[model samples]
Target: MAVYQALKTAGVDAVTIDTANGFRSKLKRDPVDLVFLALHGIGGEDGTIQKILNRFKIPYVGSGPQASSLAFDKVKAKQIFHRNGIPTPRYAVITTKNWKRILKNWQTPYVIKPVQEGSSIGIFFVEKKQNPAKKVEAALKKYDRLLVEEKIDGREFTVGILGSEALPVIELRPKRKFYDYQAKYTKGMTEYLVPAPIPEKLTKSLQIMALKAHRALGLRDLSRVDFRTDARNHPFVLEVNSIPGFTETSLLPKAAAEIGLDFSGLCLKLLSMAQNGSKEK
Candidate 1:
């Protein structure tokens, strides 16, 4: 509702449509100028709604259908990164048919997650002492396919992309084993250091790498690229969030604030970008 109120305060007749129920009928009844998608997870962020909007010739405030789909699927996104010469962790696909082979070939100290999930849902880290076979079997029962990714031993950081510019890098310090779903949403579980105190050179490099990942995915207006730097400080592109959260306290808005862009201003900027079909500035 933050985005909704922001638009209302900006003197625009904004209406909120819950995509769960009869949003289509509502759109037909009260056609709005643009759609500020605040939806998350499967049906919302996985290009389903974007494809619908494209069919109806409605302009939305995020990437197109192709980019949304690519960003939603971890396996496909990693492939795109590899094609563009973007550095990502080594990974392999695990299925019911190939689970045994993966277990024998792949090592521990890796992450197992569903291909198309968000907010770190269903993510598990198998350490050196733990047995990955059980986790792999159980996960395959729930999810059709999973990704086994080599874990990067280093600090975690995220770079928010606004238009063509990369916002300040924010280092994430989680109080848990890794930044899981709870650590991400719980108020005090994680600490975020904006404009993370790093050398100017490394910061700029992260920002540039984030922009390249965004462009490679054909994303527009806004995005958030996650990163993991090794012990040697070599940054690897984890994944890109094509449509990240937009609340006042969300990471993207927080980064934008560093550059003197307030919450309302950020909302309006994205809206303006969609309305004018503006490319990266």
Candidate 2:
């Protein structure tokens, strides 16, 4: 509702569709110039819908199918980041069979999360002395794999990228243990600090790392790169949000607003970028 309202305010003729029946039929009936996808989780952000749109030769806002898929899966994105020498937390991927074996070797306080799920769903924090193996193994019975990452204690920041330009960083301070699903969407559960107060050099470094992560995944139009600065003040890339939320209070829009880009203006810019076809600047 917020995204549509923003786009409408921006003078873009946007229409809403529900994937109840199928998007193909809707696309065939009412062909669109481009799609600004707002769907979250599973079938939406996991690249399934993007692949379908690509099959129909439709140009949509945000990353391509491969990039979307890679970003959606936390473990795979971390692998790409590691391979490219991008700074990210040391972690291990766990399957049900090897969950115990892997956990036994990992140092804790660590984060155990669903590899492909988003909105911070199904995330658990395990302390140093606790045995996460059994619990993690039980959790993995419901999912294919899980990502266990070293918990970096510091501040959480998210960088919004419009094409190749990195927007100002937004620092998230959640009242909860971590920025879980509830804190992200529920009002007043978190405090967002736009243009995070960090050293200029560190901010620039973070921006560079974010752009590298974006390009590594072949992301297009826009994305939000999350990070955590450790005690040593070294920033580590957490994950990339290829299809970030477009709600009024969403971090991307907030960061854009801080830079004098209003909601409508931001929407228009994204739409224009999509129309222009990949000349990111």
Candidate 3:
């Protein structure tokens, strides 16, 4: 709805597509000027659709295939951040065979999550002494790899970036134990605080870190960077969402609003960015 309204307001006709079949049909029927990718999770944000768009020579919003792929895999993302000296939570990659070995060395209160899934789909917190190793093994049995990270205790904040500029920070207060899928999409489950109640310096630092992470992964147009500030107020990057949620109540939209950019304006700006990029190439 935001993208449709934005394009209409900007005097540009917009067409929405869903599923692989629909996308293929649209490509066959019309020569599209640009694609405002608003799809989230799995096929949308996990680089599958981006790969197809690239093959079709379609100019789309958000990051390219490589960036999208790297950003979606939390384990690989943390590794990239570590190699680049970007601060992220300490994590261990768990495989089915070596689950016990990894669990033996894991610190207390760690988060176990699927490597590639997003929207907090398969994330769970495991306590120190709980023999959830079996649970972790069973959970990871479906996937070849898993990510177990030392849970950082602190406030959850997200920074939205428009091009290279970082918009205002939005704090997420999850009603659940953590910001799970339910807390994310369900109404009245999470509270979003604009201009997150943090010191100016810390907020600015988080914005800078978020922009760095986005650029590090080569994200284009817009992206949302999630972080958790430790007890000492040091921020740690969780992951980057190249194609963030765009619902009226989404965090990126809220942050954009805080910085004086309405939903339509934000979408239009993103479209313009993609259009300008295509012209350059």
By TM-score, the best candidate is 1
lDDT of each: 0.90, 0.86, 0.86
Q: Lowest summed lDDT over 10 consecutive residues: which window, candidate 2?
A: 272-281
lDDT tens digits by residue: candidate 2, 1-281: 88788887767788887886786888899998887888888888879988888887777778777888999988889889988999998998888778777877887799988888888878899986887767786787888888888999998999999878999988899999999988998999999987888888988988899999999988888999999999989999999998898987789999889889988888788877777883331
**Candidate 1: 10-residue stretch with minimal lDDT:** 272-281
Clashing pairs in 3: none
- Give a tens-digit lDDT track for model 1, residues 1-281: 99999889989888888887888888888887788889888888889998888776788898888888999999999999999999999999989999788767777788898999999988999888788778778888889999989999999999999989999999999999899988999999999999898889989999999999999999888999999999999999999998898888889999999999999999999998888782321
TM-score of 2: 0.95
TM-score of each: 0.97, 0.95, 0.95
Error of 2 at 98 (Å): 1.0
How many steric clashes between backbone atoms does each model show?
Answer: 0, 0, 0
Clashes of 3: 0
Q: TM-score of predicted model 1? A: 0.97
Q: At residue 138, what lDDT does model 1 achieve?
A: 85
Model 2 lDDT, full chain set: 0.86
